[model samples]
Target chain A: MSPQQPDANPSEKLSRYEPEVREAYARYRETGDVDAVQIVIIAMVREHLPKPSDAPITDEQKLVEDLGYDSLAVAEVVFAIEDTFGLRIETSEIMQISTVGSLKEFIAKKLGPKNE
Target chain B: MSEARVMPTDKKGRRRVVISGAGFITPIGNDWAGVASSLREGRHGFERVEFFGNPNVPVKVAGTVKDFVVESMNWRDWKWPARYEIARETLRGLAPHGVYAICAIDQAAEHAGLARGALANDDATGLYCASAGSAMMLHGHLGQMDRTRGERGNPMGVVSSISGTLNFNLAAHYKITGSVCGFVSACASGSHALGYACDDIRLGRLNRAVVVAGEELNAETLLPFAAMRALSPQSDPNVASRPFDTARDGFVGAGGAVALILEDAETAAARGARALAEIAGWGQAADGHSVAMSHPEGRGLANAMKRALSDAGADAGEIDYINAHGTSTPVGDRAEALAIKTVFDTNKKQPRISSTKALTGHPLSLAGAMETAFCVLAMNEGFIPGNPHLVNTDPVCEGLDLPRETLNERPRLVLNNSSGFGGSNVCHVLRAVG
Candidate 1:
């Protein structure tokens, strides 16, 4: 059996969502770009990405439980995320997408090619 | 936290708003006795200062409240923390029952022997306030915001800096949950606040209202006036504000707060409250010209005076005194004189005019209410207060009957004029109650 490669540090392993998220947030702030929806979803996940000092994070890492965000901070982040992606995350959906990976999947389903 | 108690009623059925008590925090003195003594002695409180830039600016001398101690009061003791400090200081020695606005609301309510929360649900009670720098405290909070922490600037900046919020906060604190608003017409702010409160009561919006006016000391506010060369630079600091003299350079910066409890004559009588003076009438107008300069003809100001007299149901000849808005600026003094000439020329007899700003540096928003307090005192005491530092009157002001010295004579009616930037003008007519 091939030797198992050590799992990359969570902070070192750039999520597929990182660059797209930063680019999307930058465009939204500068030009109110409507084309940055996919990028904003990626940014939202990156915002929850753990630092290298912290334990490795996963799609299953709960936003409040793992990231230690208060309701107010979470609400603020959600507000920013909504403004960026032009989508309304219902209160129920907010509860379900507590983990970074789950949120990404949820955003993908909401922003499917047909829904643009 | 419970509901405010209602005042007991007597069978007499008449209710009146009276000057049951009075207070003053002025440049000449902090208490009523001291202020009165200073006035009687012909004391002018103007002095020079270097606090603002352009020390060489010719405007020297102002009427500054002497020996003010900003540390005497705690900052957070009142609902509107900053203004409460100023208001409490203004009410330092006054009796508790007199109705007042701004910092004195609670004190005034308590002094009036009304139970706490007595005014809370009273729709017939309201509040009116006026000032320019009431919201100045927010600047400090904004400065404290940390950008590194991703902090947005304080969201409370605009609300705290708004000029009208001073009285609104006072009303809210006292549970005087009646009709509330503030007027902002530059220097005319105080007079307008009182005038508007009187209107609200007369129009039946409320049975009584508290009219309060105050100006706070702040660097941002002082810088603007200094930039305009409107402040005094007297070296002595105590002698910088001189109002009507030929050598007068400009006004000194001073802050003051005053409150008036206004009630209908019938109501005051029914309540057996001591009637201080009847608020006869008020007039307001605009210069319709430069925001910072008055019309040389004084036509708009003259009209306001005339309207106030008419509203008071008194002819111009019947007015015995005129409290002028003489800021000691060359143009302002002259424009006011011209306006006086226009108004009095049409009357059978011209009233004697004097400026309280001679004794109290221009308090801006508080000037009107402070002057109003002076008028109330003048009518009640039967005295025409002197123009303290005036030596040689301007040639343009020659024909006017200016008070050379304080005179102990009762006047039937007094007309107080306050004009401000943006052409805003207000005139109040007060008559002594029997």
Candidate 2:
């Protein structure tokens, strides 16, 4: 969190979403592997996920058909992910994207060569 | 010989427009009944501003709304200051004036018994309002942009900063589809908006419109007026705004929004809605004679009043009350006095005159709407708002009946005056209706 955040308490964590997003970045960042970050990726997708779906949030869960995120909410989630991980995600990547595991692998590949 | 000239657009079904509801937030009162009762008793709304405490800032007093705090936007919890972060995170921009405008419109909608099911299917329910400027939000946004050299700051905040966003926000919120406009005519902005809304309804274009005169007091807006020597010198809020009095200095830069519902009389009748007052006539003119000052002879001011009276087809003598644009400045009060003299002096019964600014302070663009609302209150409640601070009228203000005490006269015709810088003058003629 920025030190100068006017409203938020300094000691408080940004959100449960923050640690989930950061852990995913570190997983692929350290191991040079995408499979290890699958749990982290699932946690990130569940931030606004409705209850009743707690049994499973598989890669095939479907972004809109199952999660109910409209285009705008999807853009916001993508932006938050990009800002948290400090990577520029392109609209082409966003539009062609489907399935959660594919997104996690795509981010890992984009972050490759820059890390170890 | 000059032949009688008829204006076009007369063929359109000229619907009669009337005020069905009014809502206001002011120093004296937040609702019409409370504000109107305060006005009848000749109470002042001026108070020391609480928000801005910069000592070097001029203009010590303001008619600030008592308890309207800018809340933080947390959609779920709705808690303030904390939700502020959530608000900034969610929307590209936000506006305090927009909030005030919505609050006033809510009051008006609820008052007219049209909030819930009334406007559900109405497509023609549009609105027009005046926004002086959302200075605080704009200035803060600009400062951040400058600090980051335009690279990081939220450029979206610019929408909240300008004077036009209120129109869009209001229309979208109310689901209005007819037309949404924000008029900027300096201090006369409110009157111009009201007058134009009345025109649209009268011209058979819109069925109902909410006209909001919204302004929020902030350092960005106040410093400019203070620099112009427009604010009164009297530090004490109690006696600072002495409109039309001999000892008057200048206006107090205050803040508030007043919203009124203008509806076609036939539609209002069909709906069985109570009509507060009939918007009989509207007149607007620019005093090209001066830019920052009104014509000393009040030619433009007189012209607007004469045109309004003519438009209403009411003789000068028929005017029972005059809500003067007496802004407490020496020049403004004198110019308005001369204009009133020229317009109504010849009548065997000159209208009773008083400046409600004595109570609410000069609410900038909000002045016209609030004063016009006060006129409706005066007509309905059968009480003339008195000049509470009128200890001595200026010599130039003589020959007019400045009501020192609140009179019990039910006015048939009320002319409300509002003038602005760059030579703008607007008069709205409100007539009593059962």
Candidate 3:
């Protein structure tokens, strides 16, 4: 089969990532959650990461401990995330977030489907 | 019984400190006379200009110092060795002395007739400064570096860009051996620097200190603000900044520097130096909100104002004038107005408020000190400067008593407010002293 060819349609293709992506997509489709926190984090990391031609960033990569980001740079990232999501991230929460995966988890907690 | 008057000093018996002299480089005009006249005349300093590739950016007006020539002065007179060549060249004309922060400190020290090492040898003497960022030299160096070169792209970038090092450089230049440091709190930086210096004196940490606020305007930084649509684009190139006006669009970006010679009041009296004004109180607060936006309710700003009054032990009704941080932004102006209402609501006696940004433009880090000069001027002249080009008033700013035009009157107490990008707010209360 060609590289472009896939057995699933676009919707099914998107669902392969994780249930969170599907839920995010559903929220986006319903209320246009363009300002979602996860989306903002993705966008910020995408811009800062080394290009595909350079070293690729893994989801598990530590943003500061491994990537060598100083406090100011991290503050800039946090600012971008807050601006994107229109939500206030407490300073305490910011102190706890050190890795990409941790950030993703934080966003998922805030944005995941409501139990009610 | 005319007994010998005892000299007041710190624990080590150094002289006390107060503000003996002040200098301002602002948008309206450079010297005190010119700035005072312009403010009194209600002159608007904004004008249209082509900032970027965008032509229809709608607004174009800024308080620009068109005639400033920084290239004409001698470099050696500016105390420190020139670390950045471009900065050296920029400082040449404007100052007869050198352009470094130390040069400013030395000049203020010299004007006050103090000895060279007064700030250095006196443990009580310290250096406090507010700067937006280190000069653009670091930025230029970083830009030239090859990212491909990794960490070795530019060695000086790290050293020069550290926010605290600028004061170290100044201390080294002026031979100031006392405690030296710089504060970075965005736009309110200069005020915080002054306030911190005052706190040290009030606490008896230093017998005297030097406070300097320096702002350098470079295309590198202005371009970013222009891109962000944070500045006014008045096309006329003159009269572009209009603060507190209904048609006010945004702030006009400009830069300059100011320095204050703060000494203990008793020491100043002994030296027979004229005490310009009393540094009474300071208040600071964080909005804890968006980095680029202020809280809509202006809660943090109100708290800062209330705290400032409490710090001064003065009632809100006692404030005669206010030097507002009115950048003319839509949200910032409204938020500040709400804050003013909350603070001065009891007697319905609104103090006269005016935006000096109309004259000086927004000097970023240097704004606090530059506005401090205006407060002193207002207190001395007993007149409140007007918000230039303020024809129409916003409905939200309706109840607030803003100075529509220049008003001549003696203001006993003045409150100056400076708010920055990261939700940092600072308020200083200045009082006229005999």
Decoy 1 TM-score against native? 0.68
DockQ of each: 0.02, 0.13, 0.01
Measured by DockQ, the strongest candidate is 2
Tell me which of candidates 2 and 3 scores higher on lDDT. 2
Error of 3 at B300 (Å): 0.9
- Indicate the docking level reached by candidate 3: incorrect
RMSD per model, one decimal: 13.1, 6.9, 17.3
Please provide TM-scores, in order, for all candidate models, with all chains considered together. Answer: 0.68, 0.81, 0.68
* Candidate 2 lDDT, B189-257, residue by residue in tens: 999999999888877788998999888777777768777888886788768988888899899877878
Best by lDDT: 2
Q: What is the Cα-based lDDT of residue B85 in candidate 2?
A: 25
lDDT of 3 at B91: 29
lDDT of 3 at B165: 48
For candidate 3 chain B, which ten residues in a row score worst on lDDT?
Answer: B89-98
Q: What is the interface RMSD of each candidate, in Å?
A: 17.3, 8.4, 13.6
Sorting all predicted structures by DockQ, with the top scorer first, yields: 2, 1, 3
